[model samples]
Target: MTRKAAGNAPGHAAGNEAGEETGEEPGEEPGAAHWLFGDQLGPHFIDPARGGPRRDAPLLMIEARSVLRRRRFHRAKAHLILSAMRHRAAELGDRVRYVKADTYRQGLREAVGDARVTVHHPTSHAALAFVRSLPSVRVLSARGFLVTHDAFGRWADGRGTKHLRQEDFYRWVRQTHDLLMEGDQPAGGRWNLDHDNRQPPPRGATDLGVPAPYRPRESEIDDEVRADLDRWSRDGDVEFVGEDGPRGFPATRREALAALHRFIEHRLPTFGAYEDAVLTGDATMSHSLLSSSLNLGLLDPAECAERAEAAWRSGDVPLNSAEGFVRQITGWREYVWHVYWHFGTRYRESNTLGHHEPLPDWFTDLSPDGTDANCLSHVLRQVRDTGWTHHIPRLMILGSLALQRGWEPGAVTDWFHRSFVDGYDWVMVPNVVGMSQYADGGRMTTKPYTSGGAYINRMSDFCGPCRYKPTVRVGEDACPFTAGYWNLLHHHRDRFEHNPRMTQAVRGLDRLTDLEALLEQERDRRD
Candidate 1:
């Protein structure tokens, strides 16, 4: 189905990809070699208008070893990225010039020296800067997102304030694209269905009986990726964390579409009620496991949202389910993408609360060997094994703990970027700095996303098997999160006390008779 472009809406701004003042035009010259970034493997990125389908221009792809060597990434993450890039290159055959080099500049020089290159805007600020430095490359508009850079810039600029509201942007997008809309209004006379969606895990259930998420079968290309990664590790050229299990995510456009169809057909109906819920055995639950594919640019957000809305229109899915899923794609995901650029590079360094603690070795290494807390241990182990966990575990469990402990936001941001398969500089910066860490001091979110043990207990099955007690904030059996939540509030009381959203949590600190003991315990707590 052809969806309406967001640019048709009034107030849509126009500029180059992600509108970063790259001093390049969105238009590309004819017959220029088109360079594909790892994330830009979709059909949209190389539409017939951009010298694809007919093979009007040769393709340039670089497998820069420096990217892997610079960071100790999750082993599975490295495998997925390499596998995806190689898979795309293989599909293109002789049309693509795939180069493995120490650096991108070397690869670019090898592929097409001093030739005019037309490439889609890169996802990272660093990549964009590098491309800008290269005189041969011409950057085009970014694909895979619902909103254009200029459109988002116009929307954000019209706000006349630094704090941009996601809900307002979401509604505007819904109207602009006519997604899930009935004439001029939303389909169900509501702009949000969050209240219907936040249900806890079913009582006594170890798993939600939802159908399994799509898991891609590894092919010869995958074997090549794994062997190369193993060789790199053996040569001491790159270090990796986590297990390199069978590739769990789609690495090609075909596989990505298959995953999206599977999600829309089998899982999206139940997604809303338990998207925030966690089952120890059911890591995916009813959630769509398409973040990696979406991030990889194998699947477009517009297609995903449109399919979900169609499901609702056909009555195969609930209104809440469709709206909730659409909100994530067109609302939160798009908002994060725009925020990453609009806030600029300096946003990554925001540390309004002045948190400066270092991440512990165990956490940084993604090892759960010594953790007694069932929620923390289980979530960490999940990440170590699969390089993924649901958003609830990510925000409430992992990101929450980091916030409670006051780890340095920049380090925490880097850890998140390296640890997950879908993680990227654009995706994690605003998310960690503003939403997860609240290190931006309420620029993107109203308050910190951290929660006490009760939240974990209510939302997931992990807490049931834990050694620590959720209600106990004192003694040896006291839950770290339960105590740490209060400790966090106490430490930041001066900053959070007067804030409307944080007033209640801050006031709760005064009710704690064991406040001093809790503080002492959290201060000494390691691991």
Candidate 2:
């Protein structure tokens, strides 16, 4: 059903024998190279020398309805992915064949027919499995990642895997990649500058400069996506959450680069210090907000790390700032991807703490004023409107609250995968299920990322504006997080008593004279 592009680039993989017998009939063209939805516009799609798609090679893209139906994705997330794919396809012109199919496998089958197909290995395990199952499909290694899976596996093998610490892996990455390194030692003399980066949100309005929100210029592609979404809503059974504002995220390479430069110039200087701060009205707060672009392959991870390192070496940005930023992409980002692949599908099913409560109703509510908790409501408002929030709010606020409430790990993981614009299975599974939820039994994290309202109070301005008291353990006006926190510790006392890192928190449980009363109060509130 797809037409072949005329002529071939010099040294093209397929060459002039486009109609050669690669499991096809006479005069039938060979299978087109299929780029999945998440494999949007990238270096791989443009430059053949860089293992990119050939200009003469037919390109296939499928907007699989199955994926949309799999979860209630944020409207902005859907728009971002779909629009970006369409935009890239249009940029590729007649060489591309875009199909809207009911399922990915069905789409690929239809696109290739009897011809032998070649596919880039997907980041998601599920997608990879699906591609591998196809008889005619040939899988190629996925590009755009800083570290290869085999290399990470080899590193993990050498480390021996007892307690897989990100710090150790991070150092290995730095030494191997030579990022932010001065000879053999790190540039700042210390491997981690995380301590320097832990300053709380700056007080007073004077320090809070004009919010430089990244509002990408709208194009015809966005209008085309908006129309598709409108039509889908009317005709399809698929449900979507969150808003689709035009001023949200950049879906094109040009806009992504602009956003990157904007972050380097404006945010990188203070990014490390304020990285964990959650302000009342400020959602971005010196954050790069480039994860979606980076994950989508619009920005290269190495380039991002090098740019930040350059800023630091030039004395334009601090070592803490630059090192912290580089660690995220080269360290944590690389680690998570490795963990996701290493652990396999079983990783998603892990529930060490056995959390089974349903997710709160307010998580998907379209209204900005979804809950009474000021901090949570603010973060959700940002996510619902823009499909993005800084990592602090994600981990400390949303993840902590859910962990305290004992929400089901799988449900929480799925919510994260659906909610965020940057979220993909490879990123969310290890992060939400393992790190945030501690559902994987501390495989991804050293401990459950749980905290009472006190931590939030110290780290952010959230507690001041909140209706509940951050310090109060139990009462009518006691913070839900505080109550839930005490309950969490009390419930897990036996398991945590031997853990040195958790000994202090476990010991605090002994100080509560009215422990039963507090637990009962929290239970009643939860009910």
lDDT of 2 by residue, 250-293 (tens): 78788888988888887899888877777776778888888999
Residue 333 in model 2: lDDT: 85
Off by over 4 Å in 1: 1-3, 8-28, 50-55
- TM-scores of all models? 0.96, 0.91
Error of 1 at 451 (Å): 1.1
Whole-model lDDT values for every prediction: 0.86, 0.77
